[model samples]
Target: MRLFPHPFAALVVLVTLGAAAQTPSSPVGSVSPTTGLVLRDDVVRALIHESSGDRIHDGVQRLALLARDNAGGYTEAAVWTKAAAEAAGLKDVRLEPMKQGPQWRATRGELWVAGPQRYRVTSHADLPMSLAIKSGSFEGADLELVDVGTGTQDAEYAGKDLKGKVVLTRGHPSATLRRAVTKLGAVGVVSSYSTPPWNLPHRLDGDFPDQVGWAIVPPGLVPEGQPAPFLFMVSDRQGRELRAQLLTGPVKVDVHVATEEYPGHYGILSGVIPGTRAGEEVVLTAHLDHYKPGADDNASGSATLLELVRTYTTLIRQGVLPPPVRTLRVLWLPEFEGTREWFALHGADPVRRVAHFNFDMLGASLSRAHSRFLVSYTPDWNGSFVNAVSESTVAFMNRFNGVAYPPRKDFRIGSVTGSRDPLDAHLDRYSRGSDHQLFNDHGIPGVAFSTWPDDTYHTSGDRPELVDPTQLHRAAFAGLSSITVAAWAEGPGALDLARLVAVHGARRVAEDEFRARRDLASAPATGVAGMHRLARAVVRAAYQRERDALLSCVQLGAPAKAVRTMTQSLERAEAQALERLDADSKARGVSLKEPAPSEAERRARAFVPRRVKGQELASFDELVTRAAPEDQPRVATVQAALREATTALRERGEGELRFYQLPDALASYADGKRSVADIRDAAYAEYGHVFPVEALMDLFGLLERGGIMTTAR
Candidate 1:
């Protein structure tokens, strides 16, 4: 449970390594595809060399062992992280507390079959993943094993009897339990669900037989008619073998689960590298809780953060990089619940909080997971220079790595003791589901860096060895470099950042406009008129996003006069782009006139959802808990609608997906000033959905009824 064995072993400090390499800049109007913001190249080189992958891996290996839910090892890890931060010489380090209502801790869980030979499928004593979180206590022997065939559906249980028995399911364990325990009288549940195998057949549960994906049963506060649910987890191989036995002959198993639920506080860890001035802050965050060996899901992000603190503190002390203009704070905390709770306490901090960078799953090997290191900009509705600056920053890795044509030098930044392979790094569009989403929802511009489609994601198969040391180094160098500039830029430095945002934002907006024009050409004859309105909306949306990005630079210290000059240019481009699109429409025989707001838009324009003071938003389950009994049914309906919007009703979905994220976006975008129509248009521009305003009313209605929000007409 100590965060590392010798946390300082991998702390490789930089020695004066010759004059720092100066990064050459572009022409007056041109920008480098890689690293648009010019800075002291010597300092950049020092950060790359000083950050040690071994150190990050060491911290991850240690943190992975302290795997418990909020009430147990997870809280202990927060204390440990605070100590580590203090040891690394960060200022104002503190372990902030948030309310964690009724936590679950599992002490005993085991699944074994007594057939011809006594065999244990798995045990919580050893793997810690054999038990699902929030499962109620239960003990039973010789329980008949019944195959429910993906127990997520009603018809799946029509002819089957599940009472006092253990049901085998490959469906989502929660979905399965919602059916079995609440309606079918099932006593215990076993799950082997994993993502379906894709190319290389990267089926985690199949490829790694002992890996257990995390699962949770219903909380103790279920409706009166429902029995408390308990769950036992097994890998795909075990589930398959058990089903085989059931098909041949009657199979029975023994199960014991000991769990306790108690009220506790979630820990939010914070520490900062003091800046030259007070009030302004550049924030960094990563979640610190997951299952054992939740390395890539979070430990990677958590561990690498220690490296950021180490590198930055050392560089400033050694005078390699100047102290930041704004205070730089790093936070390690429990994921969603903790973030929401923290925001409730400091949602309106008077200090001019600037931007946020969230790092998650940043240590996966590209070859193993077939993953690309992805960086997301702030959502277009809340655009900031983070997207443009970060895109240009990480491009350094992609362009400078491996061999190239024209016989250029390979300036790869790899670890001496880590994998030295070509990195599959890319810049991505805005994505949800990270700490950054919370910051953006709270009104700060934020970006998240991560790797996706990880092979061992959420499975016990994720271990320290699965993390590539070189990958950690890559993330630290790129992440630390961008944030340091954000926190440090002023005067000329701020101007450089503005220029970066202007050029990149222009290209990005142009790309969105091009797509709109392309879609316009293919609009159906009957829908051409509507398409014109849609195209105009797209142009207007693009203008807003890019304009926001340009404006964020002033916070970093860009001159107002210069920024105004740049805005005029963007306005001209916007007008010209719209004119060109209209000209193309005339050529295509659409001959459409500019349109006015439709009836739905008018309704949206008049209504807004206003937040109630100190009434913080929580997760779907917690929100249900807040509602009165009569309103609970409405909460349930809204929860389903929310799921369909963000997750397409399930983690995996059918057919083509539209802005299924409308459910997630509405609450975040309901910042009092935005009319329901403004929220809808932003959602349409960010995601390709032309939904009716009525589709979003259920959530606003629920929030207003719960006293968390008020709808103003």
Candidate 2:
């Protein structure tokens, strides 16, 4: 699990150099038709050679030293990042302040076992993660500890007093705090939550015993009238020890936590590498905020951004690389909250942002962290050719790095320094967890580069020593190459991108067809109509995606004639695919139309739902409770039924519900311009079937009650 490869491994790699160069097709230079940028052999060679893992490692180590739990930490990180950007010869480097409420910082924290022999447990002075984030100041002596397993549900608290006690649970700190402290009147909480073992890589052997990085909720973000409580995160080892002691007899702990909260601003550092075009840019982004010593969770990502900027700026300055035709802007943010604020403020600009390459948890060593480098795309629903470009770039790098061949036959064209291990990287489907989600939600094309199933994620065990420099280098190369190609892509490059999109779309359509066919085969007779409807809808969606990809080429300044020809060809291909699917449905005797709705259902469809802008769901819930007292019981009943149905489906081993589940797609269709019937048709077009007319009406009625929507008569 050490960060560095063994000396014997290094020796073996060195001895196999001759055999690594035998791949004759692995040429040094080639033109990328998609970007219209020639892959200069000397420049490519220099990029790989000059990208320094040491720089990335050192940057991570430096950032890891700052206490990043509050506004002060945010400020310090921004300062350091700005300095690094300036050093890299980047322009327009500055910190943009986001309007946020007071920040929380722990001044002091300590815990001690008082019963069965007094002994020290943990202290914030020694290790910051011992104190949960956002935990308020508290002092307690000889407080009894009560076990409330996974203390989120009401059943977990049954038969337990919990009052004035420190409740223990194997749940996320935030969830445990809400139940054990806010509801059950517990003075504090101790949680031993770890990432699920099943989700981890096989090589890790499920050995994640690290303290959680719990944070107290910020002032404005916290729910109205709820008191934030003190909480502590314990490693699994400590929790097990405490549990064993409790088995012997009653146990007590002495705890003291001194924390401060004050008004502060979220800091975002940004710089630009101006290109020939004034308005177009490709964004390179990573979040800079995390707990102290949060190396892999975010320091790795932030450091990788720094290293990439350094590499690009250095190359551009030395005249080894041409400046991109479009600007490359680098941004360091404060994760989701900060990203949301930034978008709200600055995202309405007329300037064209081509794409975003986001880095998060990008420096974990494959050997140490049991991680694979993942190039995660935006969801298929948020269709774009960005994923294809990223995949192609990573494929090239992997081949060059010998990831696809034996060590003896591996090409080390980009092996500047570190282990000769092939880039253990692959492309992953869209997943929502990081800042990239913000961009995707706003219709921006974004991709996330991350190391998945990080064992030390959000834990004290996430420290600088756990980061892998070689991994950082590979990530930088992947991100840099991708953005470089995107920023400079012109007519020929745009055509190349269009081709990739066409190929990718065809494959996606085939995959969807297969899934739909399998679903249809297993469906009940009553569900056959819905299955066919879904098939038609999926085909239409695929065609729309292909259309959007072709349109992007036009946006990228491709020749109109070429783009037009490509679009026409793609449209024809899509038509044929759709026709084939329709024929298959007919042969299977599947009906593709639904029965007409009743008069009552027609009335419901006439109702138009206009969403209440800027209202949070919780606020909307309260609004509904106040505005439609008569309908409250019905809404509650529906909510309970939905939850039960979801639980049953999950229990039956169905995967997580798709986006069209319940009211999600329905809500999106709730523009005032769309009637209830229109919305139903739209839903049918996208999902292949609509919710029952009554179900849709009930949802809209609830939305109306909550002021989330105003229905037209």
Top candidate, metric TM-score: 1
Q: Which ten residues in a row have the lowest lDDT in candidate 2?
A: 21-30
**Cα lDDT, model 2, residue 277:** 81
Clashes of each: 1, 6
After aligning candidate 2 to the native by TM-score, how far in Å is the CA of 169 from where it should be? 3.0
| Residue pairs with backbone atoms closer than 3 Å in model 2 (clashes) | 34-493, 35-493, 133-214, 133-215, 133-216, 134-216
Worst 10 residues of 1 by lDDT: 21-30
Best by lDDT: 1
Regions of candidate 2 where Cα sits further than 4 Å from its true position: 1-46, 152-162, 172-179, 196-207, 210-228, 401-421, 521-526, 590-593, 597-713
- Alpha carbon lDDT at 289, candidate 2: 89
- Model 1 pairs in collision: 645-660
Each candidate: RMSD = 7.5, 9.3
Relative to the unseen true structure, what is the C-alpha lDDT of residue 464 in candidate 1, on a scale of 0 to 100? 83
